[model samples]
Target: MKQRPAVDLSELPTFGHGPRTPTWWGTLAFMALEGMGFAIAAGSYLYLAYLTPQRPLSAPTPNHWPGTIVTLLLLASLVPNHILKRHAEACEMLPVRIGLVVMSLLGIAPLVVRWFEFPALNIYWDTNAYGSMLWVMLGLHTAHLITDVGDTLVLTALMFTRHANSGRRFADVGDNVFYWDFVVVTWIPIYLLIYWMPRLD
Candidate 1:
């Protein structure tokens, strides 16, 4: 057989350019919107507090203890979530999975505690202006938390499957972690406003 020169593979064109991937731009835009939403809600809570002559009504004073517990759990979840996000970006699956599971549990446990805690406060959405504001703020956050838990669960499942092998896995996990961090970061000020602040007197 005659000797033949090897063709350079790098010169060949690959299949049509791969499909476009999702970028963090959309996620950043979403976060901006969410930040505005929280700011408006928090402003409303403060405004309502200011408008009332007897703000932070003595009769409907919020209990600090329950809020304290919830705050602790939310604050704690941040650690694992941060770790998992870093790990996911590095394509380290085991730690990401462990962190996701821990983060999910930490995220949900507070809501469960709040379930019992909210009713015990004996304040209804219609009870008073303060009551209404508190409910609206907490309710909005709770909705976010619910969505976060679902997203984390989905990510956890994907981490264990072949789907995670796709190129977009990093983006998916990254976005989820970013959102989770948003939830945790946003809650800090909210906790201060709702839990630590002295009741309107």
Candidate 2:
């Protein structure tokens, strides 16, 4: 019996970055499901607003400041987020470490600003359909923010330890950046809906 020569497999890298990694695809699929959720919620809000006599149902237009501030912060964070991703891709320990620490803090800043944002709404979630939808949308985004920030914090902590040496860790950092971009980008529409919709004729 002639057995074929077995191919040597040792030359291949154990892991990869971006699409080469399973985690990246999983993150993408997760984002698709989440994006659908956001779309449905946003659609429902529009339907309710269209059916109502008054768009906000007598609630004053929400103060745009807090949400606006959060928006600005999220937008601003992109700079450092990409920087982190870049360093992570290169597996550069120092900048990746610095970026993660900075990201951890940047992540918290919005959550903190978001606290003020809910109050700025000037309407309780239970108040009416508009209020409920607004809160639901905002809450959805807040949940994402919290999730990503927590993940980033954990990764940041891990990056400081001996465990940071692996390419897998840097790949995780890159994925965190990808998810953070989603979180930040999703907020723009939510922001417009929450803050600007009430004022529209």
Candidate 3:
């Protein structure tokens, strides 16, 4: 004879807001780990720079213009990203679609500027510790930028289809917006580290 334990399970709602869903927890976990990665990379940069008291680890003072432009573009993107987040929260399909298109453009613009940033560093990855750190930091952030942009493009296409009507898709959109904010926030200190630190001499 087998005994079964009975429990009531009928009252839970099938669909809930973004924060109530497992996907939101997954997204938060991902951001926390990624943020830790950025922190470690930044700390490494500081440690290496601290050791070099002479002439900035054999690299010239990098041009600040390209990184500055990218930072500005990233900051500018926050406006539309917040708008997108608000629309997603409201479950407004049309606005979400429009916001996706706008965000896709915003994501692409920074990526284009990011190319110029590498050259403006005035150093190569193989040079020395300073160069290597700068390249690694820039490369790490650039990879995130490309990844999130690709995701935005794909989600933009999805929103134009019948899938846009689904509530989960809207939560996904909110998560994307949340991730983009992280991407932008991480760049500020990195930009300063890569561009302005050498000039302190």
Best by lDDT: 2
Instruction: State the lDDT of candidate 2 residue by residue for 32-133, as single tens digits.
Output: 999999999999998998899666788888999999999999999999999888898888999999999999999999999999999899999999888899
In candidate 2, the residue pairs with backbone N, CA or C atoms under 3 Å apart (3 or more residues apart, or in different chains) clash, namely none
- Model 1 off-target regions past 4 Å? 1-21
- The Cα error of candidate 1 at residue 145, in Å, is 0.5
Question: How much does candidate 1 score in TM-score?
Answer: 0.82
Cα displacement (angstroms), candidate 3, residue 181, comes to: 0.8
- How many collisions per candidate? 2, 0, 0
Total clashes in model 1, counting residue pairs 3 or more apart in sequence or in different chains? 2
On the 0 to 100 scale, the lDDT of residue 122 in model 2 is 90
Sorted by TM-score, highest first, which candidate order results? 2, 3, 1
lDDT of 1 by residue, 81-119 (tens): 778778866767777778777877887798887786576
Provide the overall lDDT of each model, using Cα atoms, as 2-decimal numbers: 0.74, 0.93, 0.88
In order of lDDT, best first, we have 2, 3, 1
Q: Cα lDDT of model 2 overall?
A: 0.93
Prediction RMSDs, each to the true structure: 6.3, 1.0, 2.9
Q: In model 3, which regions exceed 4 Å deviation? A: 1-13
